[model samples]
Target: MKLLLTSGGIRNASIHKALLDLLGKPIEECAALCIPTAGYGHPMGSPEGAWRFVTGRRSICPMVELGWKSVGLLELTALPSIGAARWEPWVRGADALLVNGGDALYLAHWMRESGLAALLPSLEHTVWVGLSAGSMVMAPMVGEAFIETRPPITGEDRALGIVDFSIFPHLDHPGFDENTMACAEKWATEIGGLAYAIDDQTAIQVVDGEVQVISEGNWRCFAG
Candidate 1:
């Protein structure tokens, strides 16, 4: 599957262009599904937060309001009871998945439990547009510093490992003073693996196993 892992969604023209390139079509032609499962796991996550994400009221970027052909909700927590045969078709038919920010490990749990993780290997044509924790979930680990809620199955810091690195999102954002470059450096050292620290205007794109950093703002890569 194609990945567009973002710190704060498409905050700049470059990131938006990268997303378009991944979509391989105009936004109006693509069908998208917004996933809000991650938000529910976070301490700050609320019903209002999930609603904002689904309605694009958070204003991180176009996201759910991207003028797609259609936008649908994909609540991972509800999938287990519904059966894969019913929801699998919805995922396969969508051109992209817009995942929201929250607890990465929590998202990882549901992805596995809901059968999405197992199905990821076959979603070669689908693009995953991830915001914050959504992006972090693709990493091998998000590091202990980012853990809000410890996922029951995976280790405290470990994640989905779909990508070969870790991510420190919201780098240097004024609203999040803790997301400083120094903090990211500490996280990199603890991670002890390939990782990236990205600000709101940056994103990491991975397609066909090739990784590229797309940014209009600050970013840094730390090698293992």
Candidate 2:
């Protein structure tokens, strides 16, 4: 599956280009799935702004829109519990999935509780795009700083483990200087997973079982 694990959202034209590059050539041919912005701490915002900005600039956003067949996972929260009738075809026919940013922990629970976590992996052919918390929740563990307002990590708090490594996105965000790196180092030691330190505008693309750095900014890959 093709995946773009961005540090956060796209910050500029160059960054947007990298995302399209990671995904594929004909942006129109690819069906897009957009996870709601509930997790990005900007529930009222549009994580798609970055996407629309880029694709609109290229005059190709509508081509990728899946018409009425597209589904939003946030809306699924309102659906009846497990015993309810099966979901619509668009939810199942989605060719690509974009998990936007937000509270990593909340997103995790949402995924598991809503059955998206289980359902997603079954879409082996689907391209999964993750940004910020969207990316963090895919990793085996999340960095501690993200839980500043929450309790400590417990076994139940662990992420989906889709990505074996722990990622520290928005490395340029203030208050995470030397001490934050030290904290990341400590977490790396304690958790025993590979670490990624990526700048705000950077991203890493994992495709066909290979990892490559994208974006115009700098990044570092740390191993335990």
* Best-matching candidate per TM-score: 1
Per-residue lDDT of candidate 1, residues 1-224 (tens digit):
99999999888889999989999999999999999999998999999999999988877555887789999999999999999999999999999999999999999999999999999989998999999999999998888887888878545677899999899999999878789999999989999999999999999999988999999999999997
* Structure candidate 2, residue pairs in collision: 39-102, 39-103, 40-101, 40-102
Off by over 4 Å in 2: 12-18, 21-25, 37-73, 79-88, 148-155, 174-183
Best by lDDT: 1
Model 1: number of backbone collisions: 0
CA-lDDT, candidates in order:
0.92, 0.61
Give the poorly placed runs of model 1, Cα more than 4 Å off. 153-155
lDDT of 2 at 117: 73
How much is 11 displaced in model 2, in angstroms?
3.9
- Clash count for each candidate, listed in order shown: 0, 4
